[model samples]
Target: MALRLAQILPPVVLLVLAIVGILLVVLPARETTKTPENMYGIVLDAGSSHTAMYIYKWPSDKQNGTGIVTQHSECKVKGRGISSYAGIRGEAAKSLEACMQEALSQIPKSRQAQTILCLGATAGMRLLDIVNSTESRRVMKEVETKLRSYPFKFKEAVILSGQAEGAYGWVTVNYLLENFVRYGFVGKWLNSGRETIGALDLGGASTQITFETAEKVEDESNLKELKLYGQTYKLYTQSFLCYGQDQFLRKLLAHLIKTQGVKSPIFHPCYPRQFNTTIKLGQDVFNSPCTKSYRPAKFDPYMNVTVVGTGDGGECLASVKKMFSFDNCTYSKCSFDGVFQPTVKGGFMAFSAFYINYNYLTRLTNISIRSSNQMANAMRLVCNMSMTEMVEKTNQMERYLKNVCAVSHFVKILLTEGYVFDEDAFPTISFQKKAGGASVGWALGYMLTMSNLVPAESLGLMKAMPSGTWTAILTLFILLLFFALGYMLLIYRARTKQDLV
Candidate 1:
């Protein structure tokens, strides 16, 4: 009877101990999922021309956090001013409300993402400072008030500081380029010997130059640390205000007059006077201009009008090159650069390929049949292509692609290495006014989960181990062995009793 009882008890005790061991290993994992109560995040990037929103759900997949997913949308307010201070007029408030509502409509009701954040640049911030009047302040408050009334959960709207805005763009650009599918991007770029990359952001309202040194890599996460080319990472970026379209053109015109001494001596209407016809061109030419119309164009003479392919293009290219001449890039001889041209009202923001090249754009705008045939001939040198037929087809495709996606110029720049050029040509000039602002709250919230800002959690099935827990496990194993022996003894006694019965 004792022998039989011991045999059954040993097996039961062994099974119970195994179950306890499994639970001890799994319990911590269950606790890890206990998320930080109902907190969701939303990011609003309000540019001079448009506003974009990004939503994040909480309890984000441990594999991939919820901060910046590709699942977001944007909306533009027609009547609202881009100025942080003045865009919201009496009618602007209603317009902003409508636009925000429209943006909200795009977000699905099923999603419970909350914690709203707003970031604005150039227009919005500039206006706030310029119109520092009580009315402007009142209007800003009203705009904020209206945004809070949305149907979904809401957090306070934070206006990003200018430096934060630039940093956001810098981080965003690095994130995207680093993730370029073909480049094996992050592994290569992040690990390469290169310490810094020049970030030239030419936006509509302001143009910023950021010289940043890759700081440190954090737990294979989306965010990386970068030391600013100037001072601090967040606010250390230097922004030359009002350096966009209008301002850029003025600067270029001034440079042209100073260098060439060819003022009012242009051969065609498109040469110097096309941008702003509002300028008076003396009495005789004004009364009876080269053509029927002679309306003065509003000009921003400070803009860099040096068109790509022109001598000015060479000069501007040289200038940018000189700035980074000390270092060499592995990809190409040219520095990574770009130009941002946003139409009034932020209706459209055209991002030209980095390294300002005008010929690429001009070719798309005024591509000729001869140039098309030439392209075909150039293609023939490498591959077998029917020049005449292929030229026609390619031209059609170019037109379709440009009109549909506006990507022709960018593509050409990438392939051609800098800007395409028939020969030397003058650079076109343009500029944009800036009103910029950024919010610390928005910065903190958006970058809150960036690896540099947060610690890495144990990702896989293996969890954080408790200190000296292994010793406890060993002790448990020994105790289980003794218990099994005692059970065996009891079972043997039971079996012996049974035999006696």
Candidate 2:
């Protein structure tokens, strides 16, 4: 009876130890695995025409040292850009109130304090700074104060340089297109092997061209070197101030007034026929620094000047051509106005006013512009359309409709003539307003850069035990289970042998 009891007790104890060892290894592993919370960020794009706030989010456990950011929500500020509130002491800051409140609602209170908030003023503020440095500083200070009132981790409110703007825009384009990095089938972020494309941004007061190039950059200022996802890129970028659609139109009007001697009933070749309007000499035509060169020597600052349109598409193209200087090429190549540029390479994404103008052209002509000739045809069709016909067909406001022809010609000339996107390369330029559910702009790129400042939580710290310790313990438990089974098998074989005896 004593021998039987000893044999049964030995097997029972071994089985109990095996079960205990298994629980020790499995229970903590389950406890250690957990899904991380989502993180949020905000970027306010204070462009020339308006201010727009974009909210983005990513998993706290970032991918490959960078956050996988995606647009969560956006709010357009109610008023014009902050620069328009230059003289009004606090108005610029007040302009951001509605959008700031919207951001508050979009992100939870728990995360608001940690969420980064930044405001980057583009060409509008840059222009204001160029014109009035004191006023620009005051406006930026007011905006900074207003942002600090919120719970967010306010970073900065400053005017972005044209170079920074162009570079950030390029980053936004490539990031959204997944040219920088992409999720692989193995569930890891990997560098995308695809070639990067160029970025063409046509704002109200500035136009920028940026693209990766292997050619030597003669002008050091036009060259920008950027590193992303462990890959480095050498880019050539140029920002033309006072050459945007709005500013170019101002320059054109100022030019006509200068050449035509500021007479009432002045003829404008770009405007549709029978479209006449009265504008103040100082405010409308020569108010901008862009037209400072064309400002008349002696004229009433508020003199009313009447202008009439002839709707001559040929004349419009010819006049637009006069605005750019194709002569000077100090470098190996030049785009226009003496700016150095390497040959435009790869595909291009045109956005902002470019996309808007392209949309209008397509809607008006019902044709896709694949080449310069096709673009010229579309421009002529829209140029000849009378105000009534344009308003009826486009269902657009009169103010916006009148400038369509002039702006369209400006864009056409700016692309083919100014930037020199030839027939073969023209088709590669895609007019896009949004990509990856986010508006195609520099703001996302700015946020992606800021995300690098955020530190990622360590996986080992999140787990119940260190990975090495866990592995060692798991191995020990697995081996113990095998040893217990082996012992039980040996006892069973001995019992069978004894029964045979």
Best by TM-score: 2
lDDT of 2 by residue, 290-394 (tens): 899998888897889888999988888788888899897897888898889888889999998999999989888887888888988888799998988988888
What would the per-residue lDDT of candidate 1 be over residues 345-407, giving only the tens digit for each residue? 101111322222223333333432223233323222212222233335446442222211112
> TM-scores across all candidates?
0.43, 0.83
| Alpha carbon lDDT at 161, candidate 2 | 88
State in Å the error of residue 211, model 2.
Answer: 0.3
Worst 10 residues of 2 by lDDT: 454-463
Best by lDDT: 2
Give the TM-score (vs. native) of candidate 2. 0.83
- Candidate 1 segments whose C-alpha is farther than 4 A from its true place: 1-42, 49-68, 79-81, 84-88, 110-115, 131-136, 152-159, 177-198, 214-236, 250-276, 279-501
